[model samples]
Target: MNQLIRTVTLLWSLALTTGDDTVTCLYSQECVLPCKSDYREIIHWQKLERQTTVNVHSFYSGTDQLKYQNEAYRGRTSMFSDQVSKGNMSLILKEVRTQDRGRYKCYTAISSANKEAFVSVKVKAPIKSVDIKMTDDGITCKTSDVYPKPKISWTINGTPKIISPKDPQEDSRGLFSLTSTLPVQPVQDSLTYTCSISSEDSTQTYIASLTEEKTEIDLGQDITIPCPGSQGETGNFTLTFGSSTVLSYNSETPQPDRIQWNGIEVKVTSKGNIILHKLDSERHAGTYTCEKLTTQSRQLIQTSVQIRTASTVGIIIAVTVSIVVAITVAVIAYVIKKRRSKTSENNGQEGSGGTGHNGTPLDDRLQSEQLVEKRSGTWTD
Candidate 1:
């Protein structure tokens, strides 16, 4: 490796280029290093490190020659021979590896003058996520199974601050794992602490937040729930009711349907609060959470939401039942009135039938009274 490093340095020192060029490639992806020359007499490609130079590919005469190609670049490196006549001396490096990251040199010789160009290959692995927590113990940032050890750092608001990480542990595959913690200190302003991971050429961040105050809302009222830790600022946010996403808001535009901001049940306001209109017991009575997610960082508070919906609203606010009760009372009163009227009608019908108290016909009673009156003269009037 030392010999290779020296050779690379010598080649770079000897080679000349018009301007510096750097090429970025995703890990495990193919990359091409641009090198073009009119001369086909000889061609060479080498990987350059600080102290070592490793041969990558080569061509000469009418045939291919790779006897000096480094073992690391053996099968993964290739050149387009057909384009050599067009002064194209580009080299294709296949399936980029973490160890393959470095500067590469391509030199072509024709007659006696040597023409060369250099291109640097950078392998990038973006940090996908980081674990973060905020509590009485302060903040904790952690990650594991990361290729190329990572550097964890913290920022209050957006200013860089001092952060110390625990000793990193390397796994059997040479991957690294580590953790860092930042102690909590009282701050009068709304506090937002961002934890970031620097992995290779990419970065990822997670945010821990402390809200300004607790929340309280009345039942049957429209409640606008601000994202936890937002400090009352507009931003990209997501609101979750129970375990489901009730709404999400992006500062870019308005969304429709479900958490789309136009759908039923929830609305993302201009102030960044999720408005729960006409709160109901079944849907709005449970726990709620607000989260913030971005490509560089992601954070979710399983309990970020504390919706202490007043439980006293259980019985007083049954408006529909009140209407039903009023209708029922009216119906009962009408039925009683109708039944009394019917009873009065039946009594009048029985009295109109006119049966004498002794169960005799009225004509017979009159005739008896007349006969008695004829004999005793007491029926005259």
Candidate 2:
């Protein structure tokens, strides 16, 4: 009966020890496996593999003993030597790997009293950034620093399309990078395209249009190009004219010299709009693209600028010249009209004495009247 009671007591004591713990660690990052013990005479952290137990880390004999550590975790496993005296036996693991996901045991002993704890670890690397840009072939979507692989999908004008991307490329840290392209035509009307990147942990999507927004600008005038759909965002921006990059900077980076682009002064607003001090028909005319780059995705807004043949100053000058010419012509016409009027008045006065009502001079008219009066017996006429 005493043997049975002692066996029951031992089983109950073992069951009351530290319960199992689960910890999720990020890939290529430092992680801590928690364990607590009042006594720190001897400590052992072991990994329970498929068929055998592997030494992850050990703390005993006044220092850490890593001579028997597993080859895969030789330089990655460590324990807090100073904190162990206060009942903290946590293990510090650096540069965690996917292969490190498993069960771990933390065992510590002091004389006859001992304690142990169990922990389960999981390592993951989530999706970071997805960059979408225009290419000669089509629109390409790319992302890097992901784990457990990722899938890229496309939606064209609200319709789902299944386009397989190239196989994900693995880096030295076992992370993934992928690229996918979708063929698109130059569209007069806007065509909406949405690309989504999905990993084991989460999903991220980016939307862009294939159509270009049009803006009319006069030559030699300042103009501000709006970055559509980016009103309140603060992110890395790149402004490109046609295929040449005009300006590129992050929100925190210093702005480049404005007069660097062939004497064109460029200014960026807090909202990511760009202002050109002077618009050049030859160089500044064409497509202007604004891209907002973030950790999740890349957004694009394009504007096609058409420069007028005449500048504002040139138009004003032309109008002024036209008004001046009109005034000069009016003045010349008025002078010629006045001179003709005077000449006609003089001619009327000079010709008045040359002919009378009966085609006779004044003296001849009087003699004729006297002859008529003698014939008609009326001399007073």
lDDT tens per residue, model 1, 19-52: 5368976666688888877668989887777898
Off by over 4 Å in 1: 1-25, 48-53, 60-71, 110-122, 134-138, 143-149, 155-163, 167-178, 183-191, 198-213, 228-237, 249-253, 257-264, 282-287, 297-381
Candidate 2, residues 144-242, lDDT tens digits: the string is 887778877787767887776589999887788888899875675555566888875554343433334677767788878766455555578788887
RMSD of each: 19.4, 15.8
lDDT of 1 at 67: 93
Q: Which residue pairs collide in model 1, if any?
A: 4-52, 4-53, 5-51, 5-52, 5-53, 37-87, 255-260
lDDT of each: 0.67, 0.78
Q: Give the TM-score of each candidate.
A: 0.57, 0.67
The most accurate candidate by TM-score is 2
Which ten residues in a row are the worst by lDDT in model 2? 203-212
Error of 2 at 362 (Å): 83
Top candidate, metric lDDT: 2
Candidate 1 least-lDDT 10 residues: 205-214
Q: List the residue pairs that clash in candidate 2.
A: none
